[model samples]
Target chain A: MEFEVDEELLDIFVTEASDSLEQWEAISLNLKKNYSADDLNKLFKIAHSLKGTSKSMGFTQLGDFIHKVEDLIAWVIRQDREITASESQFLLTTHGIMKKWLTGLQLNGNTPDVSEVLWTIGEYLKGEIENLDQLNTSNNMQASEAHAATETSQRTGIEFLKVRSDRLDSLIQIIGELSIHQSIITHSLNNNDVQSNNFKLAVHQAAKMTKEIQNESLALRMTEVRGLFQRLERTANDVAESLQKFIEVTITGADQELDRSVVEAIQDPLVHIVRNLVDHGIENEEIRVAEGKSARGQIQFVAIADAGGILLKLCDDGKGLDSEKILEKARQKGLIKDGTELSENEIHKLIFLPEFSTSEQVTEISGRGIGMQVVKDTIAQIGGTINIVSKKGEGSEFHINLPASLNMIDAVVMELQGNKYSIPLQELVEIVDLNNSKLEDTEESHPLLNWRGSLVPLHYLSNELILNQDYAVQREEGSLPQAAMIIKSNDNLLGFGVDRIVGHQRIIVKSINGEHENNDTLKGATILGDGKPSLILSLSDLSDRLKSNHRMEAV
Target chain B: MSEAILQTSEQLENDKYLVFRVGTSYYGISLSEIVEVTEKLDTVPTPNTPDHVIGVVNLRGEVITVVDTRHLLGQEKSESHLNFVIVVNTDKGKVAALVDQMIDVRQINKEIIEESTSSIQSEANSHLLGIAKAEDRLIYILRFKDFIQEALSRLNGER
Candidate 1:
């Protein structure tokens, strides 16, 4: 039978299916921790909803497959039998199949072997039930997969809600347009001859209404990180079980709300961290027992909001990082000097270096230094910071801090090189007045200032960003500014020269539009309260610009 | 063609081609596809978009991505004294293409069908749906959806 589905409905269906699949993956990962019945219920609900929608949309193959997966999950929950390692992998594979089928359905196509696939999945479900009884009888301590399945079964059921991202995006865009219209109307009224008090009040009320609408629309797109964190538990379990070791995963602060985009971006890195904990961090159960520790290794994921950022802590109580070993590895690899005065933090940071690894044998999870470096780069791109703390034997904890919102931001306005630049207040430490004696620019010497005992590099934003050349020339033969702002990055601090401070303002950040080469330095653009356009400085780029300036001076 | 309602109203009885200019050539888009004419304003630029997409603009708060007519029609960009955004509602979505200036909307009879030239590919061949001769003026009709398809295809190739 033909289905009367509009293109919009089809688009929504595809988006919803994919979103559910992402959530399913998260839940599957969460199964590694003690299974809360809620996660399983949530997973079941998503599968059931997809089944109904796909069937209605005439995507019979996809619909049938989802039905089978949902049925098996329901049976497993009812039986209260622990899921085995192979069974967990089967569920993951089922998720992959569903994703593949959904892609075909999205393109208005059908998946072949739909029935055969469902039958195979059914066989796996039956096999899992049979294995459950055997697992219970054997009660093997080494059976970690069974342990994960058992834990997953005991948790309270969670019902999943399916929402199309396109709907959310369009809603957000519409809200944005409304705000823009309100701004335009306000601007037009200011220019009009009849400037009455009632007109001003009306405009003010409109602005306030639009702002509230925008906030509500944006809030609708946020989901808690619990779903994302849950997946890491399952991943750690799988890895530990594969290595024939006992590992227990714990989750803390699961109720922290994260933007949908952040939740999606953090998934891969979180998975990688879990893999590392299982592979390198967690010792074998025998070794762990011998050390007078619990036979099962423990990995904890904690989420919290600190200051203006969301902090995610992934800690594992296995074997913490060995700073001496890392230093030794660095020296052996000729990447660092032997006996160089490097702090624990500095040594730990080396793990993110390209091709830096202390592993003797490369595993499927990690050993190639590319993983952590990628995590570092990705986190930075999302305007997030990651700090690592590792003790020699206790464990390692990766603390990740991310901004609340990347699109709109509050910035501190400052004049640099006679041109205006807005700096994100998150990275700003403080502003200090530099006396004439403290500031010196020689003919051959670079603009490097010695602040305190450490040398604080001085960078001129005008020279670095070349704003003067791009816009109007800012050199008006005026006295040098006395106040220099000190900004801090992960480890280094730099002082920037600005003409004057223009106080703080909230700005609607417009992303730098184009596929230009200069995208690296320009974070985005923002319109000020008075309708003045300002460039929001990228802290990462600012640091790089400093290095480049020094390199140019050296040349 | 005979059974189809050729003329729905006396005003529309004359095969009037809604003539629009793309670069130097006078092109016509069927009146049925034409939604409205509005000034080019409030275009939100989409970053990393394909080349032909000038950007997206909110028309009554509806974000519609606009295509550059010159770029889509494979013509060179020229400075125009007056330009307007011709909003065309196509099957893909509502799009407003940049037009060099909207000329007069006049009447043209169906008898002016000229067999497309051999050397000069049919204007109908590249989203130019049909051509009609009205006195000395040749009105080039465009298929709105087909035009958008071709433009998107060209962009896909470039990317």
Candidate 2:
């Protein structure tokens, strides 16, 4: 027997299988909460399509496995009975195993052994194994092994967004036409000595059209956060089940949209937050009830589109953060000096410090070394901020504010050492005129600026970035900076001195690729209105470098 | 007879190269690797880049990193002069290389290329595929992909 596999067909099958399994998992989770016939029919159709594709692709073993699952679904549909909790669990577990097999097929060009899963499904079909408990007890080890395999193979898959062909075609066509139009405008403006009012008006209209097209193109990458919320729901369910807790996960504004890249980047931090909430924030049933709260803890995910950004609130109706305990822990860990005065909010923020875990005993759920610091860092990497608000017993709320798009940002351009650089407006506290402001220069340390009564360390941007040799020479000769931009990093205010302040404008950032590793000074490059590339300064990174240097000097 | 014809056709398909001048030397890159050539545009200086990299330029709406051919090939930097940017397609993306002048697109057969020897090998010349003698000049046929790979590896190594 000879078999020839069509590589393209296999790729299509893998993509389809991956997508179908994702839908199956989501729908099955939904069905578990409330059984709906329409949802069940959707599952059946997915299974049927998968079976047909697998069989046609000559994956008989996979086809057989799906066939048996299809038969069980058909039987359930025929009986017209609402599935039990254990039945839904079995289906979810089956979904997990099939997904594992799909990953194996994608990676190794053939499906892995699924005899245990097949036999379990057979028993379910024959009414021998009636519940998930029996299935778990019988094949717990095998199930775990399958899960491990799935986790190992997870890195092989690539993320893809599915856009309609016509939409893409139109986008391409518009872009082509837009470039042609731009060249035409430039040609006339460059060649013609005099510009008429009509020509100027036409150019204005073209610019407006270009802006609209840009917005339209950017909107194409905007996806609803529903998918991310659904994944979080699944995580919450799994974590709650493992910890023997009851939690009702409610989501508001799941339809709110974010950039696809931002959504993907935020998934891990969101999942970690959910797990931490379930494991530590939410109390157990007995404790919750004794504390005059509902037995089923409430975890709510609310996303709202605010001005130029999205605000996500993850609220848990559990035992709130104990500021006293957090402060005590911080002191014990030597994170803060003894008798350090702090507000309640500052104490609550201590949990986000590295190696700050309030868990007395390490658990498999949340406290396995990865702490809230990682969550904060991940959020910060995407130009977002996470803050916490809590009361002693009224539960805690984590507010995450993220920009609508990752690439476009409003920035204040500054001239430094004859070169232009921009800083994200969100990072700027205020711009101060050096000539008008009170500045203190001493031989002992870096110059400090008395900004609103508090002394802030002032660093010359040109001197720090070494933009050119002349700046260093000028600094040696004691030349004063023209202006200073105030930046807040790590709860400390720092002043960055620059040559002059340019006006603020929205710029699209483009990553500077190849060989430039010193990202602490430069975030990326952006093309200015005059068709020149300008660097975007990373204020946080600069502040971090300054803080580390300050610490080193103190030592 | 048919096999000979097929072989000749394959040779014809692979023999074309775009030759250009950097300093006093000539270099050839495979025609397939080149996306386009245009008059050099003003480049804004980037911080923390290698000396060979002449910062980035705005090409249409996209920002592209431009590499200086003189510094890359270890030749003395040229003063004020007109140049051309030959945009080459690599595995990563399109990168534009600045050259002193565009010579001509010449077809040199694979059989005429002499394999590079150790005598002329240097850090930069290591990226050369072979040397081809045509008319009165020797064109150093560059393995452009390898050059890109080396540049990326050097960047990573710096990190």
Candidate 3:
């Protein structure tokens, strides 16, 4: 028998299958929270669609797999039984297999072997589910393998939707105020003003609806951090096995939603840090047993939202940082002078210096501290900060703090010579009242401020940008340029003078063409709420420009 | 037989052009090449670019580069601000040519269009093809692709 398919049809199948499987993967994560009728229906519809598309396109095997999944979903919904954790994981693994098989089919008409997956689903369908104990053991052995094969390893950079979270937050905040006003009006009208609580209740009801709509829209732009955690888990397993060690990664807060661009930027650094844990942080089984601990090493990978940022804590119960060795290495590298008393935190931070490595011997599994500098550089590049806390013989924890979203950042809007400009909120260290701050060289030399114990440079943006000012009108003499936006770039702190601080708003940035992109001062331009182009400034670019200018003057 | 017939019809209509004036000088580009003509846009100047580049304008939510056609032709800059932007399609993407006004469209025969010598003093002459007539008024027919290529090269080189 001969079955034929055209190239165009195959292309459509691959694209459609990839999208469905990706959606299935995200839903499989959500089903962990609470199973709703809508989710079940969505799952069933997706499976049925895949089955129909594949079968009609003459892909018998792929269609058969999807058909089996559809049957399982239909059965689960009919029975109304709570989906076991193992069942959900199995469903996710099936999506992985289908997606990979699609990739294979595209390359050469080869299909994946899903008999193992089918058998597992069959057991659940027949109500002869595998015991939890058996599933746990199997999970320990297979969790790492399946995750590596599935989404993360082969996944493209997560899609970045250029939108403003600040704008969304403002909308959310406005609706909140409207509801509050309704409550106030309700109290007055019921007693003295009019005579109706219905108006108040209705306003409250409208607010609730808007709130739900806001949450749903926000959810569209965010994905669970669990997908990233799984990639790290896979790295741990591969590296641990290669080093002949046993390591298990347990993750909590896997449901934290994150911006795709933040996830993309942190993926490589997270991999490096996890590989370091397996190769250096976790002790060998024999050593663990001798130390009165379990033979298998344990790693707790946690993700949580904390204080306006995403916090990732990677901890391993293994041999902690050897301070003696690190101190010696630091001294040898001339990072610190002899007999210099430094705090434990400062000593640990020395590992991030250029070319600093404590790994005596390098192997295939990434050497610890070898690319710690790279990890540090990358984290800094993404507007993130890293901290290391460790105690000898106990364990080590690396805490990384990253902004909530990358594409849309909160910006402080400033009024400069009647033009609106914005500076990123994260880059601002403080805003100084120039009248209170002491001026160092106001008249003759370069302008510097006596900031606390050190001198900080002051750059007038108007002077730097050489903006033409036609101040045809005069101001009152005492109306000094009082406010300044102080930002820290590299190790230098500088102040930019603005006429007025207009307040903060979330902005979506659009790129400027050729020369402006390479220009040191301007980051990009964003259209204002009033439909005018406003420039977003970069302090790092300003600092670099200042330093170069200062160097040229000295020469 | 059908292929020969199609070629004949295409050649007959190929000389049809849309005539527009950038300054006092009148010019014509192929009718098929213009994408749109828009009222003066609120353009934002990009710092440190070539002098001929007026700026970029947000045209119906899409940003397109705007060029000062008078300066590109090495003629006197327009005394009065020219507000109309003639949006044209090119291999390099869409760009707007600043012009004082849009004149008219006419079909010209090949015989009446006299080819110009390449030795004209202005650099833009290399891109201007020949002189033709539309209702007794002379229209300067242009090979716009050459002009577009020159514009793209300047954009890249300046960067």
Taken in order, the candidates have interface RMSDs of 8.9, 3.9, 4.9
lDDT of 2 by residue, A325-381 (tens): 888888888999997899998898889999888878878778655689999988988
Better of 1 and 2 by lDDT: 2
Please tell me what DockQ candidate 1 reaches.
0.06
In order, candidate lDDTs are: 0.66, 0.78, 0.71
TM-score for all predictions?
Answer: 0.66, 0.82, 0.64
Q: What is the lDDT of residue A152 in candidate 2?
A: 49
Give the alpha carbon lDDT tens digit for every residue of A1-555 in model 1: 245567667667766776777778777765644467777788889888988988888877677778887887897789887765555555565665665555444444554355555555566566633432232222222223322332232232222344557757766776666666566666667778237665666567667767766666666666777777766776676576556778777778898877776776767777777788888998988888898889888888898988766899998887889887888888888988766798889999998887776666888556534478888878877778888998888989999998766665678887765445677887678776666427556554346666675567676545455321322344667666656678886567888777788888766566532222234555666655544446667755667756776799889
Clashing pairs in 3: none
Model 1 chain A: which ten-residue window has the lowest total lDDT?
A133-142
Q: Pick the candidate with the highest TM-score.
A: 2
Q: Top DockQ: which candidate number? A: 2
- The sequence of per-residue lDDT tens digits that candidate 3 reaches over residues A1-555 is 016577677666676677677678667656744666678789899999889988888788878888888997888788887776656655655655676677666655666576766676677667687532343333333443444443353364232244457757766776776677677767766777544565556666667766565454655577678778866765675566457788767889998868776787788788888888778889989899999977888988998898677899999988878888899999988889998997787778888888777788786567544488889767766668888998888888999998776656678887665666778887898887887888777663448877777787777655555432221123345555657878887656888777778788877666553234345456666777667666677766667777788799989
